[model samples]
Target: MGGKHSVLGNSTLNQSPTIENIQAAYKEGDTSRAQELIKISCGENNRLRLEKHQLLSVAAGNGDLEAVQYLLKEGRVDLPREPTDENPAVVAAYYGHEDVVKELLDSLPGTNWIGLRRLQELDVSDNRLTEVPACFLHCFKSLRSFNVSRNKLKVFPDPWACPLVASLIEFPGFLSECLEVLFLNDNQLEAVPQSVCCLKSLNELYLSHNPGIRELPPELGQLSNLWQLDIEELNIGNIPAEVRKEGPSAVLAFLRAHLRKAEKCKLLKMIIVGPPRQGKSALLEALQTGKVPQMMQNETSIRTTKWELEKPSGVKDKMDSVEFNVWVIGGPASMSTVNQCFFTDKALYVVIWNLALGEEAVANLQSWLLNIEARAPNAAVVVVGTHLDLIDSKFRTERIATLRAYVLSVCRSPSGTRATGYPDITCKHLHEVSCKTLEGFDGLRRLLFQVSCNIKDMSNAATSQKLVGRLIPKSYLLLQAAVLAERLRRDLEDEVQYLTDLQLEQIIEQNPDSDIKDYEDLQTD
Candidate 1:
């Protein structure tokens, strides 16, 4: 305890707080003396003349947790709604008294006293807190505005880790769904967490002056209510300068576009099926080196040669810049049966045949196309006529046209006249290519790229649908779990006066489906 002169020496002479006796008691952390002075001032005739800030500020700033708790227990003081120079929460945070800060926040009124319903706004700025207190989420249940600016924090607090947030499943109104403003400026944050995307009601987010943040998670675009985002002095280089200049709406739009592109850019599985020596491998070689293999000898491929086609430069659309995962099945024509395992509705089926064999080429093409269409009913097929350089130049034009028309007639949809009932194979395209001279190779490559882009787009759309379908069930389960847990917690609290680790484990073992077993396991260590 300090001397009476030492306690009151810094206060104004006329102020009630400067009264020598009370000042000395509070300054010396004497909860009993302080309470006695409070009772005298708050006597029946004249209520407590002491200011709540006077007692709270000194106790909190001095890290006197017990004295602060005593004052709160007396029920004579209430937490300030807005932080002022003498606010206890502010003073506690400023002096790094984490326990005192927790006590101030937890003392609010409610069944869940730590909830934010009473305290709508909190500012703990300029405090050198290395991390946000874990109790923050528990204490600030309905908080609409929060600021933790100019702190040494490295990561934002995770709402999921907070017991109050978990309990919100039963009391939806107490959730952070109303939170509208947040300021996290001048911190050491390196990456924005995906958990922030759950803040659907968040509108304004300030994250300026954080030099280490290199990129924002695209999931952040899921914050549909967000209208203002500030990242003024971060190291994020991927965001376009034009978008950043236009502001939040433009930045959100840009992020959405990139997210769509990422979702749509699935690998295109291109399966090349043909007779043993119909230039399937040669086409792959030509696409890789851009040069035709001259006078290639006929060699049977014993297994599949798998390779990928890197997207060429200058391709703008993400759909068009797909990387083709090429799978060329080799060996005898009989091996085509085993190739059915690789057939996928999302793949591009290329059926090649040696056109130099004349009329015999039609049968080879039909056999391979029908086999693939049977396994992959919705797959896109491209009929490629190979060995065109071996055909006589004079007859090439007429022969190629005749072959194309015949193939189209065979693959056309069955109508009133054509009742053969062959699988309705709508060929994507028909083209002739001389692997030796590389005559029509570029056109073939372009067509494959276009088909691959279309298939990837469809796959992305299906994936998005599945994700949305899963969310409804997931949300329902989460709400159910919350309700059940709250009910079980009440039951346990009523049965036992005090909860310990061993007691909680025994209760969980008795009620197996309480869904609290995981928490007990975590506490075991």
Candidate 2:
């Protein structure tokens, strides 16, 4: 239908494509003429000159969904060892051939063309796929040398490693021994996957052009069969010029040397202390950016959020930035000691009060201050009053003034029940805001940053700790990765409760990261 501008111009439309004619059609990419020629050729010759795999690819690229569906009805189509530029269904999607793509996607699961026991290879090099195609996962057991390079895929493809697909794969390590070569170059991968190390038989790996690759996995050196490992054009800052010049072998060897014995993150625990229905959740959301997760209707006690606080420019140099592990304990249940084991001296306690409760707000604030004193008396506390937007214009100023005066009295460290070790509780600053209107949050952030600048963890100060940079193991984030992996496993199994001390220690010690040397030289901070 795309005019009679055929590759074989002036030739009859019903004429079958010769081997040379089909080759010419392929060079021109996909067009209606290619589809017409393919239809005439298939109708004339049951077995085409080229392999079915090649034909299927070209047919899909030509947007001939009928031909693709017919060809796939035959038994398994295994990709040959040699690479081909024409991607079977991926090219259809890449060229915006929607019908062909729809046919491939719709037929993926039920077709049974690719058997679970067989080994198939695919090369989908230049399709702008942000994620791995469903064909990759469905063909998990069948793939031998899968390639999804030069795409927008940020995640590594290991079906067994992913919990959602793990259950579907009856055998997890099928690809480990089978896969020989992998092409993951020119993508958005953040870090090298240590899981790739499990592919013991892997020979050639292409990881060049990924600018987001900040660090290499330490266990990368353990790949015994690796001969061609490419990291060209990556944006790694720490790699030495000499190592980079020495080529892939030298770079691979350098991975083990880069293993960190220690790692540290400038992290603080910021506790949100307030009563329920007082905008504590909303204020926490706006302040630290940690989402106050929706709790089950029956269970409402505590929620934890990780807030990364960037240091303002022109602040003192030694301390650049810090992460705040914001612990939001609101609702009627979390005020009790049983729910507040997160209290610490190194934390910034943000005590919020509801302005709706006039005098009772002060009583609630006092009750919270008492708890902070009993547990972490020396901790920096910032008092906040929410619902400022609801206050009448005439009364708002007086209400704020009164609250500010009360906070000033508390900052003087009034005499209270004196514990032996705990110091006098003091509120460093008082601020009022409305979570709904987002008023006074910028000033609140500045106050929080000021408190963070001076506050130091007592334990970190006492010890002659040298490597704050190397505490968690820097060169590779596998230690942090192991912890995260364990957390994911727990979440998947619905084991959301805290683990025992012994369990946590075992997880760290064993680590499951080969580069850490069984973490024999482990130290606590």
Candidate 3:
């Protein structure tokens, strides 16, 4: 027992920190030496000082504001040293140590300290900030990037109205003309001040998720240097023909409405055939027009449309047909249900859409040919590559050549035409269309015209056998249903309005009327 060595005996063998002197004083319950040791070790380069950095930071982490103050004041610890082991400011702010944070700010030298700027990047998300603090103006002036997304700020901070005027007095020219990004997403800002447009150096501004914003200022176009502007969730209701004349807010509103109605509509005819999300719908809209909104996307598994535009066949004939029923068969890849609604004598005009634009385009062409020949022999078969614009120009050229070859191989030549008394198939093909540029649209229109014309000439008797397979003879059923539903809605609204009008009239009638006295009485008086 006497020969046994204690763990403390080997403490000096390795340069491990024992804190023996401090411990001995602590164990003895003597406060004097412990205090003296703390002063000395925290003073400058005491041997154990660097080793105890984690412990010192832990003290700061535990909200020992006094210890933090001591460490910072002793000049042993770097106050703003690239914040490792969980940044003190971040932790303090996260834990709601407002006083400690305030103390740190007060202790920081005027020249070296960046006060509210530290709060910019720290995650205080979901915090409800009604107004921006005055000090933050100083921060914003000096700030290059700020993310206040997902906060509940109802109005633009008052400081933004003047661009750091008050802050500049304290630290002259602290906020030099250099700011780049500002995120005000998920807030309740109805209108942004024109002062924001003055930030010439700014490039990206995210103002998404503010639903109450009804308009954008006309001056927004002045920010010519801006690269990315995110207004995804703002309630912009319409698009205007001219951005400058109508104002930026009106323009954005117009764009939003366009995106909502046009981007995801059945008219876009976007059959997404890629791996997933290669901006197929976006591309379609860009081609259809020039700008697309974020809300235009297919969000459901099954979406069926009964609109005039859903079926292109109806649109062309709308001008001519006094009473006609037209519908088209198309949708997502998940639509496995045969388009029985449109096909009676078999497919009249089959649109073979090859979405992949891959080597399999040839195979797809061949398969479609077989389908057209077997299912609807007389129907005009049109094979289309939907995302042809996405393909590289070089690869697209090669694929076009390959696809044409395959199509010609599968198709039979006209019955009367012959190659040395042998029959051969004649094929027509087209390529390289964009939803963004409106290119190849004319070709598509012409193709549809040819197919529709061919189908119109088919004899009723020849198509009767195929039609009988699923003939309910209900051409007006859908129209009748829609009309009935719309009529009922209108009738209910009219009845309600009529009743409201009668009540308003009764109230107006009940009001007391005063007798007129007259100019004659004044003359007599």
Using TM-score as the measure, the top candidate is 2
Tens-place lDDT digits, model 3, residues 1-525: 011011113322222343455445545656555546656666545456453453333344345576566667774565553433244544454334555655655555673445444433333445455544333245433566656667667765445564444232222243325667777788877765446656666677777888877665533544545656777656654333233243333343333323222221111111222222333344334433444334457633323222121223534432221111223333444552343222333333333445445555545445334433444445444555565666667786777677665555545453434223211234553443555445565565554444433332233332221111111212123323444565577687774322344443343334233111211121111
List pairs with backbone clashes in candidate 2. 262-470, 262-471, 262-473, 263-470, 263-471, 263-472, 263-473, 264-471, 264-472
Best by lDDT: 1
In candidate 2, position 91 carries an lDDT of 52
TM-score of each: 0.41, 0.42, 0.32
- Model 3 misplaced regions, further than 4 Å: 1-78, 81-85, 93-99, 114-143, 154-158, 161-176, 188-195, 236-525
Clashes of each: 4, 9, 13
Model 1, 469: alpha-carbon shift in Å? 26
Q: What are the lDDT scores of the predictions, listed in order? A: 0.63, 0.62, 0.44
- Candidate scoring better on lDDT of 1 and 2: 1
Clashing pairs in 1: 42-48, 114-139, 116-141, 301-331
Evaluate candidate 1 by giving its C-alpha RMSD to the native, one decimal: 17.5
Give the C-alpha lDDT of model 2.
Answer: 0.62
Give per-residue lDDT, candidate 2, residue 391. Answer: 84
